[model samples]
Target: MIDVEVAVAAHATIGESPTWSASERALYWIDIKKPALHQYIPESEALRTWPLTSDVGAFAFCEDDSAIVALRHGIYHLDLSSGELDLLAPPPFDPRLFRFNEGICDRTGRFWVGVMFDPVAPAPAHQKGHLHSFTFQGGLRCEDDIAELHNGMAISEDGKQFFLSHSREGIIYRFDFDSALGGLGGRKDFAQIPTGIGLPDGAAIDREGCYWCALHGAGRLRRYTPDGNVDREIKLPVSKPTMCAFGGEDLDEMYVTSAAEGIDIAEEPLAGALLRFRPGVKGIARSCNTGAVAKMARVAKRRID
Candidate 1:
């Protein structure tokens, strides 16, 4: 398998999300603190960036030539070509109290996103956040009361398990999932970030059923087997790797994102750069949980009323 950690761009202030667009043959990522979006084309070594007006937590691809972006203030449809944002859903929660965090599109074309207590408020440890599932057809469904900070979300290959991370707690949990209805069940511990090392940031799994988690502040990624044992560790140059996604022509590469928000760039030069390396096993590509879509004719607004 091809393997190497290559610094792909100037460090983003807070690089949090890395997504591969199979259609564009490129990678799309975000700089949370900078509040920007980026597209990196490997073919021509081209990079394009668009600045956003809000602190975008996460986004996922859509068939409508746009991305469903969960912004600081609301959910919007971001025009891929023009970078214009049209409101899809207004602030479902109080913007002053919360903002979007890590989220993705599930195999059924339904979107799962979570929120975190406003970072500037009192310690997030005791604060309550939430994870929500949204469908163009069903509108939006709140899955559960997540922790103060949420990250690391992905579904298992069989569509029966849901993986989520409570970063503040350094714990990644696996839950029973109802793929047909997009419901979450009881959660069990999948892994925990070792003390004094790093917090679990974002995570992904490979064809081998191994879980790959970005351990923020540790400068490394950890691969956990199905049994929740550490199988491998991929180290990096910087100390704050935030997220990782599988992309590339064969989907064999793992692209990682990092944060430079609280670091001294001079001491850690590659802190905010996008990095990629190939893992032997291919990754499970994300899907748009369209099963929920086919059930509804039009997106009738509900909740958030």
Candidate 2:
């Protein structure tokens, strides 16, 4: 068994979206229930948190040192230094019913984000969720297929394939992607996890093209090959490992985030802590948003000026 250690002994409610900024040499993640963005600097063992007014699901770093954030009401451009938010796109569905969930930026600078039924809202007989993409040239494009909860979102290294997970169904779906036109086709089942194991959550792709995913309820992380075969798995100290990301000066360290919101801390000591381990594999640098949303923010600022 690979040894894992606790990096941050945080009591985050719903820790998710572990992203590494190579330029900054820091790891940034979100606490969904707490509605905050956290930055951890490994070299200095320093941590900084920026409080947010709305619930945030996921975010991607931008080339301008800012970030694009998916919040409860809509997507926004976040000023990391000031903690200010500028509206990029308003939520298509009613905010009371649906909210943005998982998201990532592709090599072509298109930000793909997912929507899911809001748990705080009254339960409906049917759930509503969809996959959407945002770009500078095109505002927002929504996919037709729907699901209850959209979790794990990752893209292949060549940018020819997209992977997404429906947590309620415990299935991961793959789509043939058109990078030039931002299109998704050839949708099919990539993999499935038995309910007994755990529902798939956030995911990241490694240099070897293997998908690393956190098993939400099972206290584990798994590596799935390009062909969707499980090649290895690691047991986590926490039961609700929500997401994993590869980061380090060398990009060989795997950092995981967990949830402690509704968990019994007495039973699960590291339930909300950030955990890390060396997975013996280096990860490719993640693509950054090419200042598209930041451009929008600048436009808005100019108009106001």
Candidate 3:
């Protein structure tokens, strides 16, 4: 495998989500602790940041050039130009105890976001986080409450499966999903990282149905085939790669985000830097969440009870 190298000069405190925009040929990601949204242009070598007051968990582009972002207290449309946020839906969690963590949109354009209990340490005996699906028809409702440290959340290219990873539990579960019928079927094991490799953080799916996950403390990216076999693994210079996205003109390159929240400065000098490498596989483009697309997707959205 080709060696991965630094993609940007940034050193985010806790870089999390990485979203690709083929139209703009730019990658959008966020830093949780810094509470900022980033727009990175590869061609011009420009990395612009939009400082946010609250920790924005995740976001997707809108038809009107704004962004649907999941903030600490609620979901809102972020005006990219003015950085103003319009409230859409309030969060289901107690704003004082929990916050949104990771999220992804389905093929039908419905956004699925997961929350986590703040200060994972001293966690309670019961799970407090939930996975929520936001759609034009269903609005925002809890889909699953089994997650604690909700991390990786990805929808399959076929739109037939929903994958969610619980970092604290060290398990990734696959759920049968059918938006047309408002379906969310039983979940089964997708993959489990070994106890020592570090917990799974964020993930992406390739065109071939392989799941690629970032191991936070293991310093590696792992690829699992549809059958749950380890198909590929690549080591990285940083120990806490938060998430990754496939981008570029051909979508052949993989861009990864890392964290510098807590680490030995000397040992992990490049801990929070953005890294990229050729993964030799293409990824399905993310679905747009706006206007006609969002309206059409309502037909496929499954309403939660």
Candidate 4:
């Protein structure tokens, strides 16, 4: 495998959520601490950004050229063309206690988002991260009370499996998924990173049903087979890779986002830049939140009318 190379020297503070838009042929990601959504067009080397009001955890593309964004306060509809944000739902829990974290859409177009206790807020005595799902037909619902720092959210290409990670605890979990009903069960440990090795961050599923995950603090991307065996590992130049996704025309090229938060950039030069490399396997195309934004818009229109 080729060594990972810098794709964008964004220097994002808490870069996360590397998402590919095949329709637009651009890669979108977020800088959480900076509070912005960024679009990078590799073809033209052009970059565009939409400044967000609050820290955005993650987002999923909508069928109608918009995006459903999970911010600190609520989920919102972001019109990509006009940069207008409209609220879709309020925070599932008290905003002061929890803030959205990793999120992705399933094959059935349900947006699944995870939430963690806000470190900036006062200590909530007892709190745990939770998983939630949202649909146009069914509103937001908290599905599971899962972890402390939820990350590494991904689903298999065949839609039969789901993976989630508790970053602080260094455990990646696998669950049997019912795509039709958006159900999760049969949870078990997929892998665990030892204390000095790395913490599982963001993840993606390849065409071969293998799991590709970024190892934050370890500076590596590890691929695991369907049977929970390590297949391969690729070292990255930066120590804090936050997320990875496949994006090139053929879906063989992989993109990674990193964080520079609380780091001495002078020592780690490429700490926050977006990186790219080839893993010799294509990735499953990301599923979008089909018609959710459009449906919400129609509802608001009828109310206005």
Candidate RMSDs in order: 3.0, 1.9, 4.1, 2.0
TM-score against truth, every candidate:
0.91, 0.94, 0.91, 0.95
- Estimate every model's Cα lDDT from 0 to 1: 0.80, 0.85, 0.81, 0.87
Off by over 4 Å in 2: 293-295, 300-305
Find the 10 residues in a row with the least total lDDT in model 2: 296-305
Across residues 215-299, which tens digit of lDDT does each residue of candidate 2 receive? 9999999999999999999998899999999899999999999999789999888899999999999987777764464676667
TM-score of 4: 0.95
Q: Model 4, 95-133: lDDT tens per residue?
A: 777789999898878989998777677764767867888
Residue lDDT tens for model 1, 35-135: 88888998898988888878889887767556677888877666667787666577667777788999977777788888888755454344666788777
lDDT of each residue in 178-289, candidate 3, tens digit only: 8555456888989998898899999888999999999999999999999889998989999999998888888888999999888876788888988899999998776756
Q: Whole-model lDDT, candidate 4?
A: 0.87
Please give the distance, in angstroms, between residue 15's alpha carbon in candidate 2 and its true position after superposition: 0.6
